[model samples]
Target: MYQNYNNNQLCLSIPLEINISSNHVAVAISHFVDSIPDKLIYEKAMTSGRPAYNPAMLLKVILFAYTRQNFSGRKIEAMAQENIPTKWLIGDPDTVPSYRTINRFRSSDQMKRLVEAMFLSFRQLLKAQGLIDDSALFIDGTKLLADANKYTFVWRKASERFEGQLDKKIAGLYQELVQNKVDLAMSDEAPKTDSKTLEKTSEQLTNEIERLDQVIATEPIIPGGSPNKRLRRKFKHDRHLIDSDYLPRKRKYESNNAIFGDRNSFLRLIRMQLLCA
Candidate 1:
């Protein structure tokens, strides 16, 4: 038997407002992103003869989403649907392009260039706003793994052992043929074969031998006793390194690097810090 106790309810409530005025971050980012010039980035539509959407507005929406860490096009579309500021930035239209269109724009080479330029522009704007400190910057590095699997790596030792065995077998066969030139006579008077088939077979064997030889020669050598084991360890330890150079240098083979979003967020953060300062 069990007894239940009716013990209490605590309710917390806070007033909520639905509408709010445009804020500086949104307005500043929108204005700064709009300052990026778009010239012939999109071709004129053939059928209806007008662009499907405003390139600038799309660009602004994408950059804003990127800066806010909302990289998914689907999410951005949802935001445009529900968020008033996003809708206003995107022109508050009755329709927005599907996520596919947004993804295509993000992946395009033109879009990549535009994003880079926008980053530079944001940096300049930050400088203009006296928000950037040439000195005193943070530097860090990270590693990103390539989308490849261990199965793709060829085992060097196994390949070398196979090649060595093949070479020894071929050498032994050649030695036996030289030692017993008893090919001077056919066994039990078998019918003689045409020279063409014999020649073709010889050529094929020679080609196969040569191809195997080339593969063995050109393949990367693993230094350890077991090439496959070494390769496994190396693959396990391998990383795609990324490094940031606060004091920018022109030419240095650093790690793979990307600016988070457009550098607009960085600029805005700096501006906020300056305002607080």
Candidate 2:
């Protein structure tokens, strides 16, 4: 059995705007968001799914959150539930969106243009009302705290520097891995030592070491001592190379690859491109 509950059942309510001051930035944000051309927002609306939250409401809530220095989607979700001005902008408690939905809306191509347009008009409005001094210096240092896998950004030059260093290290390791005369054919292929190539090379070294172990198992021990010191030393050396050097470099390259995936930027022009591509 469940208790009778209804989201829409109204008992007693007052106008949400009454709780917010008219001069509040949220009030201004609401007006600016409403003034955004409907066609611009409507064109991006999804045609199939549950009804979408109004784009104006999302913009107003986001802009309001910005004024409060809250850039995270999860924080905005909580704000919608707890903040009076935010609640007023959303207009209905039932329509409060999840962090995922809020982030998707915030990061969309359409949202990018809309935010720029809104701020441009907003700045003009402020200037006309003598609310802003154009001569004053402004620095936008707002840090984004969103889904890191999807939205975290880093500079391209920094990524390139790191990549170049990794490539040099890989080249050096490859030369060491194939330095022996038996494996000299691999030296020609060393220049192609990308992550996958290194991984394949590691597997080859493992197989060669295993084969050597089998040969040592069959080889006669010298009278009373170690089985063929020559093969034993060779096995130990190859094992150390893979365990201490090659494997670690391979894993580092793979981990850095994942962290730096698709998020690099050019710091000066600030274009978005893949870090690894």
TM-score of each prediction:
0.39, 0.41
lDDT of 2 at 257: 59
Q: What are the candidates' C-alpha RMSDs?
A: 22.6, 19.1
lDDT tens digits, residue span 43-96, model 2: 656679888888778888888898999999999999998888888888886567
Q: Which residues of candidate 2, in runs, are more than 4 Å off?
A: 1-18, 130-277
Backbone clashes in candidate 2 total 1
The global C-alpha lDDT for each of the candidates, from Candidate 1 onward, is 0.53, 0.70
Candidate 1 segments exceeding 4 Å error: 1-24, 40-50, 133-277
How far out, in Å, is residue 199 in model 1? Answer: 66
Pairs that clash in candidate 2: 156-265
Per residue, candidate 1 scores C-alpha lDDT tens digits across 89-149 of: 7765456767888888778776778768888888888888899958876545533444333
* Superposed Cα deviation of residue 160, candidate 1 (Å): 44
lDDT of 1: 0.53
